[model samples]
Target: MPVSDLTAALADVRALLLAPDDLVRAVAAGRRRGVEPPAAERVEVRPVALRAGPHLQLVSRTGPVVSTVNAPLGERAAAAVDDLLAQPFGNFHVETSSQVLQLRVTKRGEAQVHRSATSRRAVQAGPQAHDRTKQRLVDPDDPLFRVLGAGGDKRRQVDAFVRQLAPLAPRALDAAAGRELRAVDLGCGNAYLTFAAHRWLAGRAGEDGAALRTVGVDVRPDVVERSERLAGEAGLAGLSFAVGSIVDADPFDGAAPDVVLALHACDTATDDALARAVRWGSPVVLAAPCCHRDVQRQIAGARAGDGLGGGRGGAGEPLVRHPILRERFADVLTDALRALVLQVLGYRVEVVEFVDSRHTPRNALLRAVRTGGPRPEHLAELDALRAQWGVEPVLARRLAPQLDAVRALA
Candidate 1:
């Protein structure tokens, strides 16, 4: 076991737990690094039926007593697994339909990994897996989906995306009440999620007998044309597509949007979208950022002498030294900065799962709802993080005016 392989092995364990269909059982046992496990450290994972739905039940056993917790099968389950990995657990055993994996951490904190094929029959003989049944938000046969070629796998993703926004729609609509609610979806490549957003909002508006308008913007003219044509054929009103970059798009015709969405916008394009949302003072913003090349490159180019490589002694150097870990950490750092900036601009921000990880790797969503003024503590936190990383997020630059006002308050 070497330092280089440890992170990859841990990442693989994470992937296995995230695979809702394959994960049968997993256990994290033993301890090391001179850190004690919380209460009962020996934890076992199994699929279980919960009142809400199917969940991955985590049972921590110590002698005759056991403490249990349940995490919904998806990104949340992956998060629970992460909490366990952060512990001093020295060994991990995972069983799936196709394989079994065992990872033991050596005294040096290096990982020794072993994996073997497991027959599906033997895997199935164990506890039954969670039921994969999920209620659909949008029917696959709907004219909107059929016309857009969003069926089967694509439809599943659409449903998941729609479900992600389902809870927030009521609140957004309540604020609009008697007025027409407007939404703008930026970087809407094929406009699948854009159309779905429109449908969801429109339906909710219809219940209250209110009006709803949704606009989809993309840089590609061809994709815009196809989306527009599909909307026409589907006879969906108050829904349209426009060709323009997120920064330059005037899809709302100068009117501020009630809801601003940017799903899977690449790199700095997401920053552009967020800047626009802040300038417009959009009440609600949902953005699922795709690539984090901006911050990733900055971290890669940082120097140890400047305290950019995770401080003077390079305490955080190992995380950024590895290409894969650096990329992943950059993603987290970028989103965290985005969330902080949103807070600085007077929005209560939440970074949560945009969709099940199975549908897409870029599942993290920044859901922001405007509350009031920025908190000095949050602004300080933002500054501390940027200073520590020796990186200026493109978003921080993009929203400089708004952030400056927040800073002046301090």
Candidate 2:
């Protein structure tokens, strides 16, 4: 429990890193004693083969995005492990061929060490960049999949969608800090993600005996009715749906949701969902934008204006010179602005590819958690981007009230 005890536990973890041949995996998760949480919420390291010989691959997840770095086995990898241990992570777990070692950092900064024998095998005899095979989180044969009429490509899609959320959902609930989790899915077409999210989250909540409630909102009455019927057939509790557009949905009935999801909401509909989330002060928000037509139109209209590779042939003009390229450029610019807007409006945001393009071309997901107001640099960058593009994002406009409030304080 003393400082020396914590140091001893860390030494054990570091020693394991040195023995790469026996190391299966190491993970550091949760937050410990700190005024500010670590930059990455979770960090994992595993043994891998590189041309030079054995190496350790470190994968760090800050929010939705993950960054990977490789260090050669031995001192370098041990140093990397030391850096990770320095962070205020509550749990440090190591798995090896012979034993599992877990070092837990209590809230009072006491160190608790637990060791147990394991039948788990060590690193395989070759360079493995990825898992040989992964167990599917959403099995194709799941009854919920059957209830949703998902099979073949549809089932694969549902599985991928849930895979994207797996890493972030638990953290989102943690942000609730043991309170009941209330979620709302905007523009939930047929409520595939709505159903899946609720089921997954409910299971998680059940683990801790925490309550969870989720609702799906869409504009089509028939879709809502079908979703409701499907929910009934699946026999899931605390899930419901409402018929209304993302812009007009009052599905929460004035209660702000803890987690907000807007998956593949078309064009500015994504903006509408985001605007609502910001206004409601939702703790966590995830949106996958589809169709950049709004920004595309703005870019086209501004082509003849200044600073846009105006017909005068500015450097930026070439990117928007071709219609197809312009469309793609708009897609990038649109999401960038949306992310920046959230950053400016007191949310920590990350833009990442939630799923592979093969599953869905519209796979860019914006994952955010409300943190606090924007720093001066973010505001300056937003202004510069708006000035250069000569286009105000629909999200920026829709979020005027909140944005204005933040700017006023700044």
Candidate 3:
């Protein structure tokens, strides 16, 4: 066929796919113009199976003949299909490669996916005054609150941690002090971030200019009592401490917390804090997880040699695994998987280093915001990982029941 004929054929195919009504008219017009409909290639409309898992599938008619198409089914896939169905008439793109006709649905139904208007806005307009003040609160020697401040290297570490979290604080609390904010710091060993959070919230400039509440929680009774005494000595009302593991801290039972802070909640404790915050639907959560031993154990267990073929241990290998390698691998896999789990759970999750290793090697922060419903792919991925590892993660197992609960609330 001539180049012109090829272009016309492509246009007709697109029209047929998009507007079936236009197909007869187009065929009639094509016939009038002496243009023959291209011979149908192998039309195989195999059910669009989701190779990754049962999370998504594409349902559409394929081949040369027209057929009734079913609406996309799975919850997440259906949403994607709905978006495709909402598109106005002329938004799809069709590409032909080899003998395969690839249909890319650009729009569906009544929705038009477009770039966000705010994309052009500057992310950092200026050095926020509130952030500067928050940083000063961690400074051990500031005249306004010298005793409340941190010092030297520790002050720098605290400054870095607070600075990372400042940008994420609820915008409404930006400049306002004492808006009756409630915060719970999990595993608050020395209560560094706990104190900083209280200072920031209580000293925040509210609409009426009032302070808020702050609470620090730890598994150690001594730490809890010490924190309470320190709060009292600082003359900070509404600042208190509680002795409880993050796994059991029920902030939702008493008072809902606006913010939940977890700094270096080792091993599965970070997941505990996250699950707690999700249950309470806390507006903001800042968690810096320390060790990731749960997944590490899973990995080690899965890679172990059994009595099967080639499963025999190599000579001089001590017939056992090295602890250091397992620990390091666990650290990486744990954080990565946790971030993915959070994303799947309908929270916008960001994994970033909260501070330098000099301050703390385990400085990774998983900042997440509750948004849309959970993605099925996330759950599927977690399931697949668990199966592959043949070992369940302590954290994942503990919070498995709550996953659906959190999704429902979202």
User: Global lDDT of each model?
Assistant: 0.78, 0.78, 0.53
Cα lDDT of candidate 2 equals 0.78
CA displacement after TM-score superposition, residue 397 of candidate 1 (Å):
0.4
Candidate 2 per-residue lDDT, tens place, 1-410, comes to 22337777888888886677777777786666555787797788888987788788889987557899898876887788788878877777686766767676655566766576653233342235356333344655679988887767676667666755654554566555557788999999978888988987886666546788899999889998999999999998999989888877776678788889999889999999999998888877889899989989988878877857344387688899899999999999999999898888888787877777877788898888777555445777888888887898998899887777777777
CA displacement after TM-score superposition, residue 23 of candidate 2 (Å): 7.4
TM-scores for every candidate against the unseen true structure: 0.69, 0.82, 0.58
**Lowest summed lDDT window (length 10), candidate 1:** 119-128
Question: Which scores higher on TM-score, 1 or 3?
Answer: 1
lDDT of 3 by residue, 1-410 (tens): 01123334344444333321111111110000122322221121112223343222223321213443332334553454344333222222221111112221111212111111222122211112112222132445533144445556567666677655543453324222344666788888988678766765554323224557677889889888877877777777777888888877865467667778888887888888887877676766788888887776555555564311123353312322577765765676677677667766666566767677777777778776554466666777776655544556665655677666655654
In model 3, the runs with Cα more than 4 Å from the true position are: 1-137, 143-150, 171-179, 205-210, 251-253, 305-322, 404-410
- Provide the lowest-lDDT 10-residue window in model 2: 120-129
Kindly provide the TM-score of model 2 when superposed on the true structure, using C-alpha atoms.
0.82
